[model samples]
Target chain A: MGWISDFLLLNDPTLRVVVPGVLLLCGMSAAVGCFTFLRKKSLIGDAVSHSVLPGICIAFILNGEKNIFYFLLGAMISGLASVLIIDYLTKSRFARNDTAIALMLSVFFGLGIVLLTYIQHQGNASQAGLDSFLFGKAASLNKDDLMIFGISSLLIFLLIAFLLRGFSLVSFDDSFAMSIGFPVVWLKSLLSVLTVWSIATGIQAVGVVLMAALLIAPALAARMWTNSIIKMLLLAGIFGMLSGYSGAFVSYALPQMPTGPWIVVMASVIAFGSLLLAPRKGLFSQIIERNNNEKKILQENILKIFYHIDEKSGETQKAVLQEDLLNQRSFSNRNMRKGLRILERKNYLSNHLGAWSLTSSGRVEAKRIVRLHRLWELYLQEYLHLDPDHVHDDAEAMEHVITPEIEAQLDVLLGNPTIDPHQTQIPSKDE
Target chain B: MNSNDLWIVFTAIAVALICALPGCFLVLRRMAMVGDAISHAVLPGIVIAYLLSGSRNTMYILPGAAAAGMLVTVLIEWLQKRLRVQSDASIGLVYTLLFAIGVILVTAFTAQTDLDQECVLYGEIAYVPFDMMSIVDGGFSAPRQLWIASGLLTVLIIVITLGYRGLYLSTFDPGYATAIGISVVFWHYILMSMVSLAAVVSFESVGAVLVVALLTGPPAIASLFAKRLPLMLLLACVFGVLACVFGYLIASFLNASISGSIAVVIGVLYAFSLVIKKIFF
Candidate 1:
């Protein structure tokens, strides 16, 4: 309880400075990240982050001091240069975008490394802790840094809010947006500027090496949960803030740990968790749905087999031996017994002496299944002009999925046909 | 140059050639970032292997790091295929996640050890010549990195020689190769394994960050200048050797970090080539 209060109370001044700054930075980056992810330009964020390193080094060299404003300005300038270089490479047909990104990323980072080493050799006391830009030093963030982040974060939020429609339009359909007179190019540049701003602001916390993760992971996680862009932005912002808070807490607890990598680690867990467990599109849910579908198909096939047995005997009800079913279809014996037991529990089958007979209630279900099968067969032969033999296979597959409503529509559409193309009598309703 | 300087330059050249060889295939496949992924992803493997085996033996660390490298490839593939994450996004996601885990593990267990994160990021290649391993019971000795890099270089040469045809077929036109009954999937894993091996070996000398630059930069420059495969391979090696020679010279004169200078030198060479090609062609 004491530890919880200590963590959550925000009594420490460092926490007050670090927490809001990281949260705002993460939320803004994640929001802008949605557009980049949709644009399939995720790695471009990576290139831009690395490109900013030389910018910071060059700024420190030029100013002979570590000023936050100069750093941000230098970062934005180099960030824009990286984007322009990538654009030139691909647009001029010199290299593919990925190659261009990789090229720019490594080259700029190398230059930054060289410049950084030079600064270290000069033995300037002001250059102390400057290398933290490689892997950030979030704990050193002060009230002034927080103020900068606060203003920039607010500006990014309002910009994204105001331009949501334009961003989405351009992201989803660039040519369509252009055709609709939405100033697609201007919208694109605006979004790029927003991305560059967030990245420049973020480098002080997350650093250049892992900045792309902050820009991408939250949105990647949020996209797994919802299809709507608005929900995606909201959820991503929430995830980013949660990760930011937790990362700061953990880093504060353990003195050796860096907050930037920890934050990314937390975001990844949420993203992977969402991918594996989110409803509708997640891996686990999809597996469950597929298994249920297979089970349903098995149950329907068992019912159809029982109807065929009664039809062959031309009797109202007949008890068929278990061996007879095994010879009719090649399903597993274990599955056959289980299906029989399930049917019996439903009051759809009666079993005595290892022979199964369809009860009255079961007869009605079996009759409907056969009716759907034969109706589909007739519809295919008459309406689609498919061969009578081909219609049987098509109808066999379609019968299980045809709902009661669809069955009624098919009956009306087929003019209440009494016999199928094979001259088999279609079971009437309530018969 | 003195003998120590010669060994350092040799170590750099060996690391360069080993990385640039497979890097050509990566660049051709448009998977230049995969090299970046493997470099960072190998961190956890190195740490865990050291913790488990209680030795910094290459035999133990190499397999552990190589396995970690394979995990990066497999995880990226799984996310893209099963979760429907975009390919580039999956690459970005998996490597960072693995890398962050590696960073945490290092800070947690090996904080006191010499395997600090700073050394891992930009390795001290100038220190390579100081760690000499005796080859013949103190009769003949070489730098440890020289032995590992050259041995790996020899193995790489053998693998490429034996499997050259299949590697070329799969990398260029996997669909065509698959249609013609070549095992494209099999070749892909083979290439990935080789990439993992090269990345781990290079990790010792160049460190992780510059390994990406070394693996990708030279070959990227090579692709711009060469039309034929053999020519590209030759040009990549030449460019790598040149970067090492010039980078070491510049670093020695300035008393700066050799690896950092080498990376800058490669970028300079790339830009230099770009200009030359522009002017001539």
Candidate 2:
């Protein structure tokens, strides 16, 4: 509690404003970043962030001081100019988008560095902290800066809310939005404007170097947990806020640490966590699903083996020997034992004296599987004109995935074929 | 020009030339951002090397940074291939995270060394002449950065000369190259190694930010004017030298950072070429 209180810097009046200001700035960046991430224009945010540096430097030079309004205006103009230039370069077929981004980012940032160096060379005291814009100076953010962050963040949220339909449509499908008369160009430009504005305003908190991380990481993390755009936006905003707060907390506790990089580090942690640990799209879930799928395929293959053996032996052998089953298809001892246990538990098979025989229910299920397989093979052979031999491999893969609806369609398409391409009898459903 | 001015100009040109060679391939493969990613991500490697070796040996720094460069590549591949993250998003994610880690490390160890964050971002190119390393007992000496830059530039020229056709073939069409018994992956790592080498060497003199300008800016300008690969490579060196000269002049007149001025000059040259190309074609 003592450290926390001290970190909030409650003794300093100016420090009171920095927290919410950072929260607002980061939240807005995350919100805007969602659209950029979805649009596959993450690097554009990077270019805009770098482009705004010269704008800040130029504003300082013009005013001989740090006027937030001039900084905003200059940054907005140059940021938009970078966007336009990139669009022009790509659209003109002169350079690819990546090329344009790298080109503009380096060029604009290089110019910014020049101006910043010039400012420093002039030995102006006001320009002393200006270089902090490269890596951000969140602790020094004053009340006026907070006001700008607050109002800009509010405006960004409001515009996103009001124009949700237009923005989503444009981001997802611009040509369709245009065909439906949604002023696609204007909406895209508006999105670009919003992106530039968020980056330009948020520069003081995260800086040009890691601003792209703030824009990208939270949105990417949010996307992992939800599929809905609105939910993603809300989640990204929350993630952004958490990152900002935690980052501020760290930088406050450790005076040597910069807030911008800490914020980025926090956001990346959240993103990596989400990627590896989320329930649906996460690595763990995907791994579990893959394992389950492999198990199901194995079980299905075991069932097919039983049906083939029973059919070939003409039901004369009530109990097939384990040795016979092993001779027909390869299954390891442990796997065979486990498969038997699963079959026995499901009432799909009965083992008597170390020999396996299918139960009545199991026989019916096995027949259905064999029927679908042969039907697909026949369908492929007849309609697609594939060689009977060639159809087996594809049908083998398709059998497990064929839905009940697809099975019925295949049945109708095959015209109730009684046998497969190899002339094996396709068991009837009533068998 | 005075000897001091000559050293500065020579260092800039050498750095620019080294970067421009490999940068041509990056631009062609549409992987310019990879160059940016590697440059940013190599910070931790350099820092880690410095921390471990407790010295600024080229042997330690270059290899360490190269390992970090490869880590960036591997991390980006994992995110894109395994995690299913979007390509650009992955690039953005990995570099920033590594760079942030580097920033924290650099800050934590500020008392132990003179390698501050500002120096990494905006290098003291103007002070390069002062940090001279004597070759002939101070009678004929060059900036240490100049020596490293020239050495790396020599290695770059040798490798490019030997592997030019292979790099060109694989970059243009990997599948066809592989069909013809060329190893695309070999060329990829080789190019990446070169990128890391250039990034680490140039960063000491020009800083990470302006080094990126040198890597991408000159090649970008050459790409605009030249269609053939040889011509592009040739023109990139020419543009790089031109940008260095003009940038030096501009910095002197304006009393600005030399590296920053070089970047600005690169931008101006690009715009000028853009206009000329647009008008003539």
lDDT of 2 by residue, A1-431 (tens): 68777656665565588788889999999999999999989999988999999888888999999888999999999899999999998998778888889888888888898899888988899888888889999989998899989899889989999999999888788889999999988888999999999999888998888899999999999999999999999999999999999998899888779999999999999999999988889999999999887776767777888899888878722577777777878989777777778878989888888788888888887788888889999998898999999998887788788898998888888887798999999988674
DockQ-derived CAPRI band for the predicted complex in model 2: high
lDDT score for candidate 1 against the true structure: 0.87
Candidate 2: interface RMSD in Å? 1.0
Models 1 onward score TM values of 0.96, 0.95
Off by over 4 Å in 1: A378-386, A391-393, A403-414, A421-423, A428-431, B111-113
lDDT of 2 at B16: 89
TM-score of model number 1: 0.96
What tens-digit string does per-residue lDDT give for candidate 1 at A350-393? 99888888899889988998999999999998889998888988
Worst 10-residue lDDT window, candidate 1 chain A: A92-101
Candidates in order: C-alpha RMSD to true structure: 2.1, 2.3
- Chain A TM-score across all models, in listed order: 0.94, 0.93
